[model samples]
Target: MSAADPTRSHGPGGVHPIARLPEEWEAYFEANGERAFRGAQVFRWIHQRGELDPAKMSDLSKAWRVRLSEEGLAPPFELVEVFRSRDGTRKLLLELVDGGRVECVLIPMSKESDEDDESPATSGSSAEPPTDRRRKMTLCISTQLGCAMGCVFCASGQAGLVRGLGAAEIAAQVLEARRHLDDGEVLSNLVYMGMGEPLHHYDETARSIRLLSHGEGAGFGLRRITVSTVGLVPGIRRLGEDFGGKVGLALSLHAPSDDVRQKIIPMNSRFGVRDLVQSLREYPLPRRRRITIEYTLISGVNDQPAHARALANLLRPLSVKINLIPMNVIDASSLAAPSDEGVERFRDLLVQAGYSCFLRRRRGDDVAAACGQLALAERLVRPSASS
Candidate 1:
């Protein structure tokens, strides 16, 4: 996390289709003894334009297109189980080519009547025209198979850590999401708030950020993406220096006090709140972007008025925005989500203290796909971390 690169490979098994745009295209052209220019064309067709079929690429010669077909370049990650909420939230369970599955979600923003406009984001470009009424859809992506930082409240960490995903695998999640949009509807924002503690996967997460913002590739501006962490201090410092002005960082500061935090988050012992907040306070932030402090308010645990005061005191020095998330029910617990009134009380306390605060509403809870509920079923199929 201290600008030290993570140990990586072509990834275990073979090259994942989503993670290997460069290698696969290069390999294809090399095997056919074709000009290198073919790689660029095919890359644009797939990543930039979001074109699936090779035949759909009109710019490529018919023979080359036929060769592409014969090579069988198909989209990776098959759609298996899809869950739709009546409220317009959709959860997609995708089966990777190797038979492993991961979840991706699409949360539609509420659009007003006359402002119902949508446009496809160019493959590598994250540019979207402004609309007074367009809903901001956020795509949550995963960085690792399972999380290493096992926060007790999260189902995703229940299975423990699997392995980190490569940069391509991370970027592929965004690419795959684009396919489901109805032609012109653009994915407005992206969050690494999915399953894993992103900063722990250090190298790939940073590399994925570069790929997403690369104008010739995925092209999502760093400003539009936020990487969430469960208090990995080294990662916070590294990201501040390396990705300083590009991307936003969100810390999962669930509990304000160490005594309470350690019980809920095991990582707290290693990276305590004092150290974590100090790093966050010192981390260079972009002009308009403030670091988001995500706090999950548990009913009888950390939702008290005293807890709010402690939290406000903890974040006083830094440029921070607090996102209060009610403890939505997790399959492993008996904790009821804090009542609407409880959430309001916490928000009002932070606001009166002159801090920016917002409540994160739980979505797709019926399918166990809401916040704190994205535990993929593959946890049973995959091997243990030590294995």
Candidate 2:
């Protein structure tokens, strides 16, 4: 039942590490000629301890470690590139079993005036090291190889759809990140906003959520996770059906009207604002849970104060919060993020009209570490699907 049992019958190996449920741990051990009790101990080391190397597992017999290692039961990934931003942001480009690379980010929230020194943790530490200072940290992980939803403004879209990552691939990003933290520095938040639209890769994404939130995996509470999409109606509704309030939802509604939205976010044309709002009404949002509407303000395109008014009118009734993200510059080059004053004015209009609003500050712009930039570089270097 140990978490490290590769033969565990959780589900098909769809890329994620701990996609299978914890209950299946015992079954995996029994089949492996080990006592059922070994399952819990192994699972704890992998999940609770965040241990990757089998040799470091002191609780398990030496024979089991050799067996596991010889069988190549370790996580199927290698960190190929680590790009650090001046603003305490670290983006890791990981190469998968097939030699394709995906990007994952670790954004540290710190009040320190200077950037913290860079030090990647060793495999021996499964537990996150504690930091000297207290600051909220969030991990951004990818769910798919490349996105099918070709949002005109997003770099992840230009690469086209390659394939969806399995549950283990997605979970491994978080598990790998745990090694870098100081003690007591558990991940405060997780966002499916890295490269792919999570809703398009639904089942594996959902399974990954269950694994991360499960007590035997990352043990992150559901509230700490956030799934973002460019308005995939079917997936949005499915969240309500399956996860209910276990995780948070963020909708990428870049425009208040279909006309402007379709130009940037094509998915809006299929699921218009009306359908999106209607779906939200039916979503099983948790108590005090307000869905976040992500609006990336593009200069002179959708940044007009009038658009803000229209947005306020559109969302007046829904229990929602507005996250005004200024557009991050990328090669697509068709749009520009709104100025600070323009973003502030838009927020003022929302607040004056009785809506909660917050401006998402620009981070890692120098390193292209902002929202949709890393995916662009990764796409260029990642082997084509045919390769």
Task: Highest lDDT: give the candidate number.
Answer: 2
TM-score of each: 0.82, 0.86
The superposed Cα distance between candidate 1 and the true structure at residue 27, in angstroms, equals: 11
Runs of candidate 1 with Cα error greater than 4 angstroms are 1-36, 52-74, 110-133, 371-380, 383-387
Consecutive 10-residue window with the lowest summed lDDT within model 2? 113-122
Model 1: per-residue lDDT, tens digit, 1-387?
011111232444334333445556678577668877777677766666666577899988898776555543455556776677776677777665455456778776533211212342332234434543344576888777667787777877776766666665577677777766543356777789876888888877887786676666667777777888998889888888897646778899988899989988999999999999888878888665688899998888888888898999998888888888888666676666777888898889999999978777667766666543544533423532321
- The whole-model lDDT of each prediction reads 0.70, 0.73
Give the per-residue lDDT of model 2 (tens digit) for 33-142.
88988777766776767676789989889998886566455775788877778877778777776666678887874433112222222222344444443345678888
Error of 2 at 326 (Å): 0.9
Best by TM-score: 2
Q: How accurate is candidate 2 locally (lDDT)?
A: 0.73
